[model samples]
Target: MEAATLFPARAIRLRRDATIRAGQGGPVIALADASLQLPGLPSRICALLESLACRDVPEADVQQDLAADGMPGLLRWQALVTKLDSAGLIERSVLTPQGPVARLRQAAVGRGPGSAVRAPAQVKLSRFTAIRAAGGKLVAERPGGHAHVELETAVTGVLAALAGWTSAGDGVAGLSPQLSRAVIDLFAGAGLLAPGSPDDDTEYTDAALAQWSQADLWLHATSRGTRLTSGYGGSYPLAGRFPPLPAVRPALPGPRVELPRPDLEVTAKADPPLTEVLETRRSIRAHDPAAPITLGQLGELLYRSARIRRVFPCADGQEAADRPYPAGGAAHELEIYPLITRCEGAPPGLWHYAAADHALEHVADPGPATAALVMGARAASIMAADPQVVLIVTARFGRVMWKYNAIGYSLVLKHVGVLYQTIYLVAAAMGLAVCGLGGGDAADFAAASGLAYHAEGSVGELVIGTPASESASESGGNR
Candidate 1:
C-alpha cells in the first residue's frame, strides 16, 4: 500500500439530530451528501469522524492522533477508513508537474469515478463553467447541472490551462502547490476534470448512442417528477416570467406546391374509425414499388397527421398553435422533409412539407448520396424494392429549447415518438405502407439538406408507399 492522505469530499456534512429514546438505540449521526451514508453511530464515533472531516490528515498522523485520543484498535480505525474510501470521502493525491492532483474514488457528476489521476498528464476539463455566487465566491458547475464546487476565482487561470487554453510551458508552472491541489480537488469533486493522456481517444464515436450525452441524460433525469423549480414541470412563470410563444419559422424559400386535403368534418364520415385504425396499425416493410403512392395520398397523410389544427391567442399578444399531435409547450418544432424516390406526379427530389401552408416546398434535387440513404432505409426494412417516399422528421431544437431550460431536448425526442405513432395510425387508416426507422445519421441528413446539424436534423424516418398485394391480402382482416 502506497502512502496516502484523506480529505473530506465535497458537500459532505455531518448531521446530529435529537437523541433517540434510551431503549431504541444510540443517537443517529448521519453523514449526508457523500456517495454512501454513515448513520446510527454513537456520539464518540461521530466526534472522531467529525475531527477527521475538518482537514486532510496523513494516514500515519491519523493513526497517531487516534491512538493519542484512545480511540480504538488499529483494525477498527482501518475499517472506518475503508468505509470512507468506499464512499468517496477520501481522495488520493498523486504527484504531478503542477503539484499533487487529488483523485476521487467515486463520481460527483457523471457515471464513473469523477476523474482519473495519471502522473505527468494534463487534466482534461469537462464542459463546466465558473459562475460567481453571493459573497464574491466562484462556483464551478458541472455540465447538466449535476454538481457544483466553490473555489477562489484566482484559480481560473489554472482551470483554463487544464482546458488547454494556455501553453504547456506556462500551464500550472506558476501555480502554487496549495492552489493547484485545491483546484484539482474542487474540479474532481465537481466532475469538471478528467485524467487523459495526450494520445488518448476522447471523442465519443458511437454517434447514435452518443446523441443523448451524459449531460443530456442527467438533465432529463433531474428535471422530471415533482415541480421543484421554475425550470421544471407545469409550473407557470418559469424563471420569473412566462415565456412568450416562439414565432413560427417562415417556410423555406423554394418552389411551393399546395396540397389538396379534404376538411376533417367532411372526411370524418368517409374515413375509417379511430378504433379500427388503432387495431390494424402495423409497421409494413414490404411495399409494392410497382404501385407507387399518389401525390394525393401523400398530401392527405401530412394534413391528417401533422397540419396545424388551430392557433390559440394569449393575453401577451403571442399565440400558441395546436397540431394534430401533442407537443410540449404547444411548440410544434418538428418539420417534415420528404425524400421522394417514386411518388406519382412528384419528381425525384428533396422536398419540405409545410404544415401551416399545406404545401410541399421543393428544397433541392436529391443527390446520389441522398438516394443511397433512401436505398439504405429500404434495405434496412427488408424491402424487395424502394418505397415511393421517405419522410425525414427534423426538429428545430431552438423552438423547444427557447422555453424549456433543462429537459428541452428530451421533450423534442418525445414529440418525435408521438408524431411517429400519428403517422402510423394515419397510414393504417389510409391503407398505405409505413415503417419507422430506429436510427439515422444526422450528419448525412445535414449534408443532404444543407441544414445545420444542431439547428435542424433528422430525429425520425418513416418510409411510406402502397403495400404489396400479397402482403395486403395477408393483413386483410386487420386492415
Candidate 2:
C-alpha cells in the first residue's frame, strides 16, 4: 500500500505516552519499558517523530513535515512507519472530511496479521470480541487482542451493523464511506471482526476456538498473553478512587478456637525430604471416618501451610504480608475457611482460619448450606466416604485489585494454586490425607458463611482428613 492509503489523511501520530530520545542508534521511541531504535532512519524522520512527541500529527502530514528537511515522500517515509509499527508505538486517528472519528492503538506488546475478510462478503463480530462504553468512549477488544481502538459513540452503528453476519460493505452505517471503512478496519485489525458464513472456515467451526468459552479465554488472555493499556502489576489504579482492602481481613465476631502452632525449627530439620514429600503427595479421597483428623493436627497443618510470617507497610499506607505460600504482590488475599465435619477435638461447624492468629474462629453452626458445601466436596472427590473436612479458599479481591488492574483476579487464582500445593505438601509430610477440589459452589459457600459474594467469595476448595488405612491401597484410583 502507498503511504497515503496506509496512513490516511495524516491520521498517524506518536502515542501520547511515548517519547523520542537521541540514542546510540539514530533515535529511540520509548513507552513504558519498550524501546525501538532507528539506526538508519533519515535525520529528517527523527525530527518528525520528535515533533510528534508532545502532540498528535496527521499521518498525511508526515511527508510534509519531512519535506522541511528536503527528504519528503515514500521509501524513507514508509521505512519509518514500518519501524514505528513494529515498535507498537503508532496511534492512528480516522478522519472524515468534517472531523476526526476514532483512534486505533496497540494494546498488547506485539501484533498479528489482523483478522481476515473476503471482499463483498459477510463479516461479523467475533464471539470473543467485547464492545462497551468506558469513560465516555466505546472501547472494543477481543480475547488476547493486540490491537485496540477507542471511538466516539457516533460509530456505534458500525458495531450494530456487524452484530451478526452482514455484508462487508453493509458495515458502513453512520458515517462517510471513508470513516466507516476506517472504523471497520480498526475492529478488523484488532481481531474483533471475523469472516462470517460463506467464507471458508468460519470461526464457528474453528476447533481451537470451540474449546474456549468466552470467560475462560478472556481470563487466559487478559492474565498472561495480552498487556492491556489499562496497566499491569502494582499500578495502583484504585489508589485515589478507593481505599485498599485490609491485607488481613478483620476478625469476624465469633468464638475463637486458638490453634496450637507447630515447632517449625525442629520440623524443618526432621520433616521428610522435599523429594519424598513430592513423591508421596496424593489426593486421598478415602479419609478415615473412625479415626478423624484432630484439632492439634489441623492446627499444625494450618501453621505449616498458611500462617503469616510478617507484615509491612506498602504504597498508600496499605499493609502487605508474607505467608508460607507465595502470593502475587504479597497481597495474601486468600482466606481459608475449614468446614469441620469430624475433626476429633473441634466441634463440627464452619470455621475461618485466622492466619495472623493461627486460630480457628467458629463462624456459623453447621446448617443445610454447610452440609451442601461438604457434599459438593465429596462429590468432587473419589472418596470411600465423606472426607473429614473441607477447606474453602476465598480472596478479598480488593487486596489485589487495589494494586493491579486488568490482571487482579488472575493473580488471585494463581495464589490459590500455590496455597493448594503448600497444603498438599504439608499434609503429606504429616501423613494426613489432603485433596484439592477443582471447584465449589461460591453461592452456597457465601450463604453458609454469611459473607458477601462479591467482596469475599470462594475461589478454591480442598478436602483434608486422616487417610483411611485400607484406602491407601486405593491411592492409585484417587490419583
Identify the candidate with maximal lDDT: 2
lDDT by residue for model 2 over 1-479, one digit each (tens)? 12222333526677777888888857877777787766756666666767767655676677666565564445677766765665566776676544556777776444444222123456678878887788888988887777677877666678878776766654266455555676777676666777446555366687877777888988888777535535756678888888877777799896999998778898899799999989877777777777899999999999999998898888566888998888877889999999999998899989999999898998889889899998889888866577788989999988988888878998998899999999999999998888898878999989999999998999998899988885463455533
Q: Give the TM-score of candidate 1.
A: 0.59
Residue 410, model 1: Cα distance from true site in angstroms: 0.4
Q: Which residue segments of model 1 deviate by more than 4 Å? A: 1-146, 149-216, 222-230, 233-247, 312-318, 472-479
TM-score, prediction 2? 0.81
Candidate 1 global lDDT: 0.63
Q: What's the lDDT for residue 204 in model 2?
A: 67
Predicted structure with the largest TM-score when compared to the true one: 2
**Number of clashing residue pairs, candidate 2:** 5
lDDT of 2 at 382: 60
Q: Candidate 1, which ten residues in sequence have the lowest lDDT sum?
A: 1-10
